[model samples]
Target: MEMIIHLIFVFCYPANNRQKLLPKSPLGGCHSMKILAQVLSAALLLLLSTELLAGPLSEYRSPVAVVLAKDGHWLATANQTSGSVSLVDVASGQVTDELACGTHPSFLQKCLDGQHLVVTDTFGGKVRILEINDGKLLPKATIEVGFEPTGLAVSPDGQTAYVGLVATGEIAQLDLAAGKLVRKLEVGAWPRYLALSPDGSRLAVGCSGESRIAIVDVPTWEVAYTEKLSGGINIGHMQCSADGKYVYFPWMIYRSNPISRDNIRRGWVLGSRIGRVRLDDSEYREAITLDVPGTAVADPLGITMSGDEKRLIVAASGTHELLVYRRADLPWEGIGGPGDLIDPKLMRDPDLFGRIELGGRPMGIAMADDNRTVYVANYLKDNIQVVDIESREIVREIPLGPSISANQIRQGEAVFYDARHSLDQWYSCHSCHYNGGVNSKAMDTWNDGSALTMKTVLPLDNLSKTGPWTWHGWQVDLNDAMHKSFTTTMQGRRASEEEKEAILAYLNTDRFPPNPFRAKDGSLSAAAQRGKRVFESSDANCASCHSGDYFTDGKIHDVGLGADEDQYEGFNTPALVGIYRKVRFLHDARARNLEEVLTDFHSPEEVSGTRALTEEEISDLVSYLKSL
Candidate 1:
């Protein structure tokens, strides 16, 4: 009876929010109302019981990565914003433990010995080691590494650990015994995540920055092979088949370049496809690509396999759910030719599981050895959700304490009111410059392949901190920047005076939250103190351009980092408040890190800017800027 009731409830509750209503009787109105009340009471009782049996999804915050551990006894998850990890008991459907880590732990992996757990902190640039004793987590160690350590992978022997440095485009190899860096290897641009083969002979590095995967030989630490991908293919996370014959990589492809006014107005389309590559073959061939339906953007982040490798678990971040695909049944070779790639018929319905809501941005997924349960990390909500894989139901939710939500974040308040302007429809200042700030990376143009500067299209985040906005630094004031966005970039009707006032109020409000690491006494760290001395010293003289509280002079100077056509002789110096968040540096987004930005030679015409600093000084300056 219990099993039947569970089945009936599961069938009635559609994965999407829509609830199916029973047909109304043609009886008298009072009788109909009585019947409706009875049905409502029954439904309410069922929901309450479900909550008692399986914890509500709302309890878990932003869960990004999920891992099944302890022979299905425990499930672990990573929460990005809350900076915590959670563990759930499978049998009782209850949260067993929730422990805090550093900042923004993106990935999780259980140690080979099953005694310790490892998590990578992308923003904090560190890896946390937690010991598991009787299903409880105890902090063991925190090892600092290169900039933006996004992805983490443990060797098959569990002797070595490889961390992908997203900002610096390098991989830091760690000696597990000493808990220190053994060496750093230069890989492709923007290396985010890694997948080790079943045999553990090779490691496939997913390079989102360069749109390729470089295979690194384990023993020799040499590049074994490189697989190039199509343009706009943002290769995120990947997984390997149990047999180790095939590799599946999920890519988030941007349909259009977001440069021109039309493209910006229309917004960008993001889609996901699963590309299968043979492990043994040197040549690249498409095995299969699945385009998920009903999702606006296919932002797939994590991929895993069932215990038997019969099903593939994909975490579609855009949709906030787990998509289980039947591997043997999926069409691999018969999609189409190169020109007509991807077949709609080949795509099938994925068994959707986990939270199906707006706030649950699922990032990583993993399965228990028995394949009976799955774990998912909610990135934004800061929690981990445990799901029964076989029953296709979320059974438990573990929460991370004291997390912020998008709605809770007050929008930047607008300051001006232009009666003549028309307001945009269904779009806010946070649309392009997400969270009131934009990525420094160059995006593709809409009409053609021409690249456009990111600064010109989106400039709301730090306008007060840096003046002379835009890539060319044409707009001198914030009002001008607002005008250009509405008239040219937004391509919407001008906003009314009242609407403009509201918009400006929202835009002007604090975009960045208070710095979590700001010193209470307003003093600098020892490293930052040395760095400040180097910055103002004549040897480095960075203060000549970057001066004042915001760390920017708000004036254009010849940095000598632009092309001949782009050579404006001078460009506006941007603020350094949150410099560590930006992966790319310089106006063109050419340099991968701050070291490169300060040291790279742009042109022979002006060498003074870059020539002023040594490599060590540049490192010090970067450290200080990150502290700011």
Candidate 2:
């Protein structure tokens, strides 16, 4: 009977695309239905396998730097949102560890031993060291530093670590063995990345604020030489060739006021180039200026040279690709010549030689042991993309999440929504507002010739909960405000209805990140406590304008902060939830810091309409406002 049942089953099964006859059964055709179900299941499995192979390998959310260590066996990335570092094994393409750091880990550097990693928290104003043990990262120590510590460097001997204090324009040299500050070198304005010559005799520090490179004597730690560049050079990352004959610096025009619609035309107009300065002499020269075909500027970020010194790799941060140039092919006509003397026509075009779309903001880059593979950190994407130097193709991508997707509700969303335009090819809203709002610096002029003001531009996080937008309170709804600002005021291209909706969806659900302002027991700072008293006091009366959770009365009042008599009049009060992110204070952005905004209130130019408070009271108010 079993042999007969097997024969009947074989007869019912089809073969070679040939139809099979159903076997007669005492239980009717239930067996045939079961066979059909099995066939359907096999087909579904095949389709699923194809999709699984074809889907996006990984996604990054603001992945800023990428480095490979463990002899090219591991990949690490610094994620901006979760304030964590992700470690991935190259062989399996798996995330082995996700190590937490201070808030907003902007830059990462691996120690000489590859057993430790240091990350700079720009917003948190601290540096954290993590130890890698058995492929897992363990938090080692956290060191408090100056405000906005950005770029980082480890000495050639690995005895000293250099930390770039961006806001203060100083370099803090820490003794690695002792784990203490040995010296603080005041270099220049807005010092970014540090590069030491291969000989270890000189240190090349790029100052974005000064638009110059300060070459410091390694032993003496003094400014041995300074070479200036033309235009507003916001120098980012730098690398010295192993031969020590030349130093290559990558710089972009600094965008102090990134939000004004005019910023695109003005900021993008400046030319960008890789400057080559000889270490032997203080002569500065343009080695090569990378011009994108049709675009006015190129913002180069990470730069490195091949071990053989034959090829130079630059991560064009603005264009979202890696740019490579042959060292031999570069024309040497512009060395030690003036800016205009460098023939713009002879410059290498990044798109012509080699360009690969990594689909993220590429910041820091490092090469593998073979020098044939390059790793790029996609800052906003939250992952490291591994590129094959020979093919210029993305060989592998290591994810840095469970990342916050565009759909994820985060506090930055509201600020990003108010800052970004629908049709922009590069950058989002928060790219300019930074954490959420402005950076408090005056530029030549805004697109509309109106002075940029945080007191005017309202936050978007709780917009649905709050009504109206802008300092004038002109637009009633968030959607309308975005449309009008992007299209009309900023001159950003009009957004399609669908794109606008996607942007709005992203903005409406932004939730604030965990506040670093709170104490261990969730109490406010003592300064903030005193500040609150001053804020509610009759003399200050800050609550008269700013009130409620979003910290706005949603009303307009003239604070008088400009030379134009008409502008001296009233403006709508903006929300203060994330006001601390803004560097500049007031409508004109004249106040250099928060203290100036409250203390300088008595000046006719600043307090054209409002009365000034005493310095002590102003300090108290500032302390209180920061608590929020």
- Cα lDDT of all candidates, in order? 0.59, 0.62
Worst lDDT 10-window in candidate 2: 51-60
Task: Point to the candidate with the largest TM-score.
Answer: 2
lDDT of 1 by residue, 2-36 (tens): 22232333333343411222234567545644664
Q: What is the TM-score (0 to 1) of candidate 1?
A: 0.66
lDDT of 2: 0.62
How displaced is residue 45 in candidate 2, in Å? 37
Among the numbered candidates, top lDDT falls to 2
